[model samples]
Target: MSAPNIPSSAQRGKPSAIPGSSPAPVPGPNRSGNTKTSAPHQEQSTAQSPQLISVQTPTGGGAIQGIGEKFAAQPATGTATLTIPISATEARPGGTPSLALGYSSGSGNAPFGIGWSLNIGSITRRVSKGRPQYQPRSEGTFARIERVTHQDGPGNVHWRVTSRDNALSAYGRNSSSRIHFASKGNKNIFSWLLCETYDVSGNAISFVYKSEDDQGIDLNAVNERNHAILRGSVGSYFSRALPPLDFDYIAAATGERIARSVVKEVDWESLENLPEGVTGPLYQWLDLHEEGLEAVFAVQGGSWFYKRNQSAAGTVSSLENSTLSRTVTLEPTKVVNRMPNVSDTEKPRFGQWDVFPPFELWPSGIDIGNPNVRFIDLTGDGRADILITEDQILTYHVSLGYSGYGAPRSVHKRTDEERGPRVLFSDVDESVYFTNLSGDGTSDLCRVRNGENCYWPNLGCGRFGVKVTMNGSPYFDRPEAFTQKRVLMTDINGSGATDIIYVRSEGVTLHFNNSGNGWAKVEHLPSYFLPPIDTLASITATNLMGNGTNCLVWSSSAASDTCSPLKYINFNNGIKPHLHVKITNNIGKETNLSYLPSTTFYLRDELEGKHS
Candidate 1:
């Protein structure tokens, strides 16, 4: 067994020993051959022999296994060891070698038999899961390599390309270039990015190419980041471009129909029809409803109806029908007052008839056609009169004359002094009276003075001095001097003269004046009896029950004997002593009344009197 002569081909560029080869002898310097030649040249006959190593082909084919005897015969020198350096281009498409073999051989001459076998095995190339390589079909063409980056801060690399020209142009103009088509491929554990970028407007434009197939899993991740960047940039661009987009305009443009169910759910019963040509905002419609427009148009038309604006030329009749729905009517030639026509020479008719003013003409009073004003005499001669009261100052027009009525005109307008014409009788203290006291007139001027002492037990005393006029001359007379404590004057004596009845706390005192002069106190029996005096306590002198004599009836507090138990005292006697009568409530009703002597003697009565 000899060591094979293997070449050191692995060290550098050299060949190893052949597979079947024997070691060859080393040639050395022939010093012994030269001595032998100098000694007489004994015929040096080196036997010329053939080299042992040789190659021979197989004679017949058999069951071929392993290397299949392909290397059975070959010259050993020719089968030297070999080492081939594989270039990147020689590698497989997926960056893997298709076949690799390393071998060595020994040098041999006389057919040195060196045999070896090789088992041909399949090789699988492992591809990475990343961006694939972008192959350019044509030369001088470029592929765009787009990469997107997402940073933590506000800035984001929206769309970046590998080409310096594209990036520079895009940055210089601050604009985005269009993206052509892009495709993706999946590797074992990554993805491949194959993209093409070209100019859409130019004919001679070239496409840029990129190959990222060999890239690892990071390529897929980069692709995902790029996708997110693209989405965000697109969204931001759209948002910026469409600013101030009103939803109402969009809805209207889209012509969205309101839901019928929503309309039905609203409270239509409360809605009122609106006038034409009026529109409202959504909030106004929701809050005010259609009636708001109707009211506005009504006010604009100056009536409770709808009408055209001033631009339309229409007649008064058309305007009336369109602007008004109802009209008001009034009466004329109405009775104001009535009285016995008395001569001017006959003492001016002591208690003359009163004339009432028309209600419409009276200031600060009830309106005309008011039920309360129906009692007013529309054609009264004293309509021009004016009443001055604390509550209000009223002016009346009767026969178009102005006279003082109701509360008396204060003598000194600026005087704070209490000396003035005041009403002698009134239900409430400090209240001014507004009624007709002179029988031959309309509503007259009157008022009741409130005295501080009037409410006190013994100190409550006041006087009303009336300045009467005779023949256009004023005469001073104290009608309330003797009949001071709450008195009323009327023709109670039937002597054609006025009398006064003073309502005192103990009883009522009757003062009769035969000559129409001041009264003199007259006391009647059973004067201690008085009626329940509430707010309705007043005296009325009238021909009640159709009697020919005037009667005096006074109402006072039941506990205060100032009055006679709400009874009538008749003075029909053509003599000195008048008749004393007692009246009773026929029933609990205010309208029913009876005489105490007998119920049959009671008669329905209409009491007419005057107040000042």
Candidate 2:
């Protein structure tokens, strides 16, 4: 036997006689050209030192496998030997899993006609046990968490969370603050966040955790980091993927608050049927439904009709409509609130003549009718009962839901300092109204007079609490400057509470109810939504568009008393955002118009339904 023809370390990059190389040359005394041969080693010598090694793929590299191997390179001069020792060993620090190692040998064209190689270790991942499965949850009163089904690969998924209502109360250190969207992949692991929620003021209020398929568990730092995140003390460490929300707008859009001053218009001349002898000064009122606002007009002769704005078959009919699906008798002489005196210039003009039409006409179960005779839901039965202010006495009639109203009982007796007794046909005093300022679904009393606003909460069972006077603001400091006619005590944001809608020559300003006597102005409708009104007697507010938003319904005293229900429309008409006021004419054709802030939009030749 002789040494094999192999290259030295100096020829490393060039192809040489390696164990796996092709067409290997055998080493012998009678073979090959410049190859040198040496006699077999007289005595074998061994040298050993500890070395760390790892096997990796083409992607990136990994840490040491913590296993060991031994090899001896054969030389062309003397016979060489190779050896591999297999043993069980612990996985390396920061390594993936435990591995088993082994080796194999074979005879080939080597100097001693033999060769050897080590087999790559096979990995056995330790399966995690007793891990809690993912479960969806909603915490606090407004924070919610749901699992995300969309996954990146086969391993794990993500969870999503959203905070609404008042964001400040969504999460904190309490149990209500912990809304789990997913359990950890390993029961011992802490939480991992994917996103976060912020309030209008840009403060983090909630976290969206990720735990579906993740296997990595950080036992030391993750828990503290997660606690810091929930506390909102982490600063802006994590990227804020979700933007802050305009709570007022979101409340209205999500029906969390009342849609304020959202008025819609309807022209009486557009309807199909009209009873004979039906003339001007017809009593009009608004009917609210989930779809939008419906305007009903009652002729003095017990004949009435309604107009609805349906994108498809919107029409004027005395028969079944959107809000009034059932036909009922119209008691003309029973209409209690008298139209306001048009000759009185200083008296509030809008909603003065608007009576809280019978609950049969307005299904919202709200007493947004006559300020004097209120039909409100003092109880949460979803039915309106009677609350009337007459002869200095306040009375109540509770609704039995499926049944009718209970008997009338006296709730309060007004003092002599209060306004005078209002008879049925007397002018409607715009300064006083019955609304749910407390948002308890019961009717409360509101009086705006001499630059001050007073509210009396409904204490259930027809009882009244002590009177409260709202603090003055720049918007409401001087009642004389804007007048009671400019103020509307209605729920504009769908907050279930009454908000202040102040109509000025400039635009409609909103004072959102703080759940107390105070008001906060979040946003307002621009000035373009001026309905044609000489007095509060001509304008009324209700849900006319069937979108659950309150809209203004009114008619011009100079235009044959023809009703124009002004639908509250917010749109970007060319230059900037303005209210998109849609008017339905007598022929049932819609005339689209744009209203901007600080501008009073009126009907013009270009704004006619025929032209549309």
Per-prediction TM-score, please?
Answer: 0.22, 0.37
| Model 1 ranges off by over 4 Å | 1-386, 390-395, 399-486, 495-497, 513-517, 528-539, 547-549, 554-567, 573-612
Lowest lDDT block of 10, candidate 1: 452-461
What are the clash counts of all predictions, listed in order? 72, 53
Compute the lDDT of residue 373 as modeled in candidate 2. 68
Question: Per-residue lDDT tens digits of candidate 1, residues 1-612?
Answer: 121232332234433333233443344447666422111112223663432333343343332222111111124333323222222223212222222222323321111111111211211112232123334345442535333444542222233333434411111011111211121221121121222222232212112223222111111111111112223333333322211211110111001121110101111121223211122211011111111110112222222222211111112243224221111111111121332331121212322334433322223443443421222232332233322222122223222223322432322221212323433223344333323333222233233232111111000011122232211111112434323335555555434334444555454545444232233435432233444333445554543323223444433333343222233444432111121112112221111111111111221010112312
lDDT of candidate 2 over 390-454, digit per residue (tens):
66566667765434456667744535233222322123544666777666455666665544566
Q: Quantify all predictions' global Cα lDDT against the true fold.
A: 0.26, 0.39
